[model samples]
Target: MIDAEGLSIKIGAEAKEFDGEARFSRSQLTLWDRVTQMAIAAGEEAVQSAGLELGDEESLRAGAVVGTSMGGMHTLDENYDLIYRQGKSRIHPFTVPKLMPNAPASHLSMAFGARGPSWAVTTACASSNHAMGQAFQMVRSGALDVAITGGCESQLTFGVLKAWEGLRGMARDACRPFSKNRTGMVQGEGAAIIIFEKLERAIARGAPIWAEVVGFGASSDANDIVQPNQDGASRAMRAALQDAGLGAGEIGYINAHGTATAANDRTECAAIRHVFGEHADGLMVSSTKSMHGHCIGAAGALEMVATLGALRDGVIPPTINYDEPDPDCDLDVVPNEAREVEIEAALSNSFAFGGLNAVVAMRKWRGA
Candidate 1:
């Protein structure tokens, strides 16, 4: 669980500082914001796991796409505090570089010496899903052989927490998604990354395949800014199924965009029902948000990792704080405990506050 006490807020799930020494040299660390630092750490881990050490020429085709909704929040907050609160005239000269939305992605590309198609996406909560989706398409189109893609967010500042509190989404208790007693959402901050490569290349290199990315779907509601729409979500799921060429029955599990908010849990359930029909009753859907809290822009990447991990180990993580059931969100949430289930195919959903939606389809990876 990433959210715990002792944060600046009433409650939050925040990534702790590096357990050991810093990930990079002291001189290098001074230039990077926390978001960039997180992206570098996550991107390096993914590249290392893929067993990819690229030559100079080959690295040109390798790329990165990291997502962040609140890029360089820590840097911006600190600088603002220094200028306004402290009555200072001067600010850090590197402020512009540190606060750019693309800084994290740029850092990832430089860290891996990847020169192709490096970028960032900032779609509120669905940022990482869109970033990874685009990366998957690049690999499919043969634009790049290897890519580092995921998301990082560190928005636990006092100012941001106060802003969220104004929005009234902060849960008084725990984040009990799909539950009757659910109050609201809790914030979390962390990064999760994945490495994507061509299936043929991975097979030739004998790289371990954790899961196969079959399809990605995206949609925009163009409706309310904060409220979600069922039609848009259903459309994305339908498109993902079509892209994957899979029947609804083929999907056995779903990693839901369950925010523990009353609106999201109910709306997401309705979308699933509309898309899957009778199969919705049989599907196992759960929200890991109950454990990790809402990671905002990084939520999709973390949930995708969780979903793939579930597929690999045949262990579906649970919705931990489910005390009571809400009829509107009456999916089999795998409430309060982990379950052992071999899932053939799974879909991870990410629906953002702006009514933007993205979903990806994955299947359990066997051997080549």
Candidate 2:
């Protein structure tokens, strides 16, 4: 459990503290919030992993798209505390730039010299998937040859924790997605960035391809602000399948947007069943949120990492902390323990507040 100024939750997964001075100059650190710093670090790692060199002719065709729910909660909380509690007259000079929703994207673009289509997507929990889907579309449509895309979040602040507590959607002990005994979600903070490149360009550069992004689909429920809609989720999944030119049966695994909340877990299961029909019986579905905690905006990107791992290593990550069977969520959840199974294709699902939903379809990369 994590306590924030006496407001505590059952579980909160926070990233290990890293030395900012080691990673950035003092001036750079002062200008960027933790969210933007984390984004820059993730972007750097992804760029290096892909062996991508920006700031050249290729950079003109590169872009950066990032996502976040609350961009700079820590900075806002601290500043508010200083002003309201301590009677401070002014806040940090860089507060505005650090707290802006697009700071992470803007900083990433500047860091990598990506001059094209740089922006951020803010769709609550579904931000990452929406952002990644947008980047995928741009690359697929020839609008850009490369995209530095993913999500970053550093929202574990006193005010943010209290706000989430007011919603009564946070778990008391653990995150147990799809389990009958599940309580609610546990908050997490982190970042994940991936490089998306045109197929020919990636092959030409001999970059290591983790997985192939085949399709993306997004839809809005237009039904509820907090409650999820099964029809909307099913439609998004079907659209992704259609765009991928694949049948529902072709999807071997699903990285579910299972928040461990009672409504979300049950609703997501119903949506999966509705979309997959009889094939749902054999599909291996799991929510990595059980292990990583619900990362909010970064949830989809982290789950996508798990999905890619399944495709690459033939091992499906488990939905940890699952205690009992859930008849409503009867699909194979691979609960408690990891399972070794070869999966050719998978889908990562993200459903957010305000009924936004996004799904991404991917397959094991067979060298082109």
Candidate 3:
């Protein structure tokens, strides 16, 4: 697993891991919702990385598309609790605005002057993948010169924790992806904002190219609401490869949507095998969710960054907490330690709960 710093699985307990007060200002911490604050913070870093001052010259030409599976859930629950549990008539003045799902994108737009197109996508875990895909398209089509695209999620509230617990996917302690002794998936909260720009523009400006988002593919299972379909997942990967103008043999690493759950790990690996054919055994696959936990809507974006690092640094992150291997997930899972390899291309897979599969293909930036 990519080093999560100190992220823990707070499934049954409180998410003491997130120190909101420490991260945001008093004004923002009090008024702006948690997810929005996260988005703003992430946007700040992302823009800084691109050496961009949005709306400076690219202000009107820049855009923001942040995604979240459950936007501002903490705000909604807290307000509801004050009125119902505390018998209070008055709630926070900015209740509706605070809890709005699109608030993150709106805040990012205002903060960074991304006036081109700002919206939020709420497609469960596939949210960020789809959002990034849209931004990539805009950049590729010359609709926007730059974009702040990613997702945020703050879903570790009491109500949300109970809901996850009810679903029975909450792991006992740590997440163990593709492990024979795996129990279930755990929940995590965070945001990741990625900067997207046209290749020519970035080249002209001489900005450091991190990785090339060559292609994105999406598909809907339309069959099961929760259970993942192998054919549908395989189709997304093939489409991503096709979109990137690459063949199966070019893929060296797969940042799998391995949620550590029995059904997901097996289904995803099997789907990869189906799509890549003989190349499956030669590919390295791992799930960083075993460290960061499943950050739900933010999973895709975070994994994308991790995969980009894999391409840039020539190091493939491992699937931590992996011990015994499940025969069903028999691919080389990189095991519990990191590996240094010169991989040219990687795939970040995100198969959401509703069978919404979004896959992105990226290659190491070797310059034009």
Candidate 4:
């Protein structure tokens, strides 16, 4: 076995400080700039967390994979405004590069000097999971010594927000997942990065391992572009469990997709029922989107950060704004505040537009 171990995630500007849950940071700059800055800051933090120096031969052997759903919507919007309203003759030279979906990965690779492999994976909201899953394989197969992987997006621009509004998935107020009064997701912006290394490499370097990528499974519904497929999600979950060498009964917690949409909550609940069956009743399932809003392409990796925090701190953050429960989403959604729990292994589920379902299993790292 390749025994890849220890990962670190750095949250971006959208997250609220523990005490300041009501307010979030806002910037005059475009979302793409926010993503670039956050990636640099987080990448440095992850490397330091691993107790390794960037540009070191071993670290260079490490890899990078990033994902984004809408590429650079904000930048695109700004340029369009300049050209259309102001009658500008040409777009900025940096426009295409900065607005590219793969820009974040390119920036990361250049910053850290990771020479092994640097690429971006894009699949709507499932992007990050796919990136992380590929990184897991790279280390497991001895193709890389370590992997710095995650996803980022800044889709809160006018054009993107208008597009999401057309989808009718935007909540007028705040997200209320699994709640009877729930409406839909709120578009948010952010990025999250994680550092992954072989178990032996991390131990040799005395790295602090937060968790291990025990299992990962991904599948596409290809059934509908906008709607979710419960059957596809259930199959992916089962595959993740099997890959982890565990059974449904072994899991104590699940970080649900719970997008607060009528279709999403019900369909995801059905998927949970299909996979966990009787054990679903005992699982502490919740969606954190109620607190952070949905970060589109950035959602999966950011939620992965939350999952790792749950493992390290032994507490699961609640799905805020949950009041009256919907019979359709009748699962035990840990609502309103963080709670303590002993989570040996946990699942983070992300289902995106285009019926993409990605599930990953994580466990507290035990150094050998």
Candidate 5:
């Protein structure tokens, strides 16, 4: 089987504290491009981790996949400024290229000289998860010896903010996942990338095995464009568990799709309990969005990277800002601060708008 080897994350140049406290610097690009930069940084880091030379002709077999939710809104906004206010005749030639959702994948391919196949997969919030899943299948099918994959997004633009404001699901102040006081998700932007290689190839190359992709599950709610369907999400989770050849009890941790929205948190909790029954509570569950806010398409890759980090460091990043717990989401949300534990196998869950549900199962790579 193709194994996902090194997983890495690079927060955007305009870094924010894990706590959704405040902006550290005045952001320049649309939150999406900044996230693309983050994915670039992480991809470079992964290359370093894999000890592979970039732009090496030998890596022509390497491919790339990146996902983004809203691409180039920042550029669009700026171009509009020129056209309306400044009365510009024509937009810049780079406008389409920079604003395209596939820009991140294109940039990654060019930067790494990955010549095999490159593409961007978009499924709203499930964008990155779908991209990663596609890359996994490519590796498994022996299309390529290696692949660099992940997602990046920056939707915290003026236009995006206005659009999200219309949604009315965002919090007025802080994001509180699984908390009774939780209002909604605070906007976030970032990117993350992971490297995947065939397991035997990785061992042969003496690559560091961070995690193994045992299973992946994807499904569509086909119910609503905005609201989530618990049944669809539950079915996806079960399918992932089955693909992993795992039972509900075998999963020790669940990186939940706890977006902190009133509907999402409650619905996701129900889905988990429905699928896992009594074993649901036995698993350590938390939403890192409490610290990072809701980073749209990049959220899933970042969460998966966090899961790998948890496996590597033996520490679970806390769901900060979780003060009052919700009875509905009644699970041990490794609340605030890192927690130490043995996480043999963990699941990262993501359910996006339009009823897109993607679940990925990862096992800590133990040399066998």
Candidate 6:
């Protein structure tokens, strides 16, 4: 098991407790990568929570859409080390199948017996939101009744860490978003899966309804690859508000894509201000990444877990590790401590590298 605190990298939110051997049978562990294992575990929990049996008829209409930035870094890294470092003649036979980007989604389909439509979305940090958006559109357009969607990532390998170090965007000690003294992002690993089904079907089955996925918006910067574009971020948020048929005033909280990098933090605040205008002052914007660390492709989904908590429990998760506030990110970041405030609507932001951005708008579910 990898020690989260004892890592040579200094800071990482690694899922150290994750063990495929303990969670699955021997045959199951051989074929699936750690990424797929996490995805399957999350998917199974979602299916059980949603009271979905995936019967023959239901399975025919159910589908899965998962997201990830790096698919199977552990598998690839281990095999590469064996070949190049140890001068091995051969690697695992299931290496290719386990490392493919679509492996999570494909494995999820087989696990749940879903057959309608299944695929994986890879958009760096915005991957999960994009995947969930695609699933939402499919269900809204009457293409499918049940959609299992989210993201998974387990990229804490030697090669991945070294590559991140080369980028020099990692904090030495901790993740402190929106803080003036913030260094950069801290890496994390995990998965979060959600089951989305028709409201009527949910009602008929008495399934617990959490929140309604109201709108989705996506945009590309088209200007820079590494740097974040404020204009592109603003456009995506504006598009989400328009799609939700909601005014800026209706959104009470915003789950920011604050990655702790100076450019990302400042750019995101500027975009929020541009989109929300005066309402920006009233928005309880916070970056859960401060606590969970940056999950890369799974960032949006993990933050969605925080966003849903705000909608359901009227408590906003704090942006912990905040020391000194930066003037550039002068927004209500709910620093250091959680706050209780009832909110009816909220938005989750996911702005990624390569100038990709995706936003999801959700509203509290009252009743039919």
lDDT of each: 0.87, 0.90, 0.87, 0.79, 0.80, 0.91
lDDT measured at residue 351 in model 3 versus the true structure, 0 to 100: 91
Runs off by more than 4 Å, candidate 2: 1-3, 19-22
The candidate with the higher lDDT, 1 or 2, is 2
Question: Residues 1-368, candidate 5, lDDT per residue (tens digit)?
Answer: 11113311112112443222132233323232455566677777888888765446547778898878887666777788789989999987777777888888887887788988989888888888888888888888889778889898876555566677678787766778888998887778888888888888789878888889888888989899999999999998998888888888888888888888999989999999999999988988889988777778888898998899887667777888888878988888888778998788888899999899999888877785
RMSD over all Cα atoms, model 6: 1.6
Per-model TM-score on C-alpha atoms: 0.96, 0.97, 0.94, 0.90, 0.89, 0.97
Better of 2 and 6 by lDDT: 6
Badly placed stretches (over 4 Å) of model 3 are 1-18, 55-57
Pairs clashing within candidate 2: none
Q: At residue 83, what lDDT does model 5 achieve?
A: 95
State the weakest 10-residue window (summed lDDT) of model 4: 1-10
Decoy 2 TM-score against native: 0.97
Ranking by lDDT: 6, 2, 1, 3, 5, 4
Q: How close is candidate 5 to the true structure, as a TM-score?
A: 0.89
Q: Tell me which residue pairs clash in candidate 5.
A: 31-154, 32-154
- Model 4: how far is 358 from its true place, Å? 0.6
Q: 228, model 1: CA deviation in Å? A: 0.8
Instruction: Write model 4 residue lDDT over 1-368, tens digit each, in one string.
Output: 11112211111224332211122234312233545655656676777776656556766577788877878776788899899989999986777877788878877887678888888888888888888888888888899888889888776565666666577667766789999998777667777889878888778777888888888888889799999998889988988888888789888888998889999999999999999999999888989878777877777888899999888888898989998979999988998988998788889898988888888898876567
Supply candidate 5's per-residue lDDT for 110: 79
Score residue 3 of candidate 2 by CA lDDT. 53
Candidate 5 achieves a global lDDT of 0.80
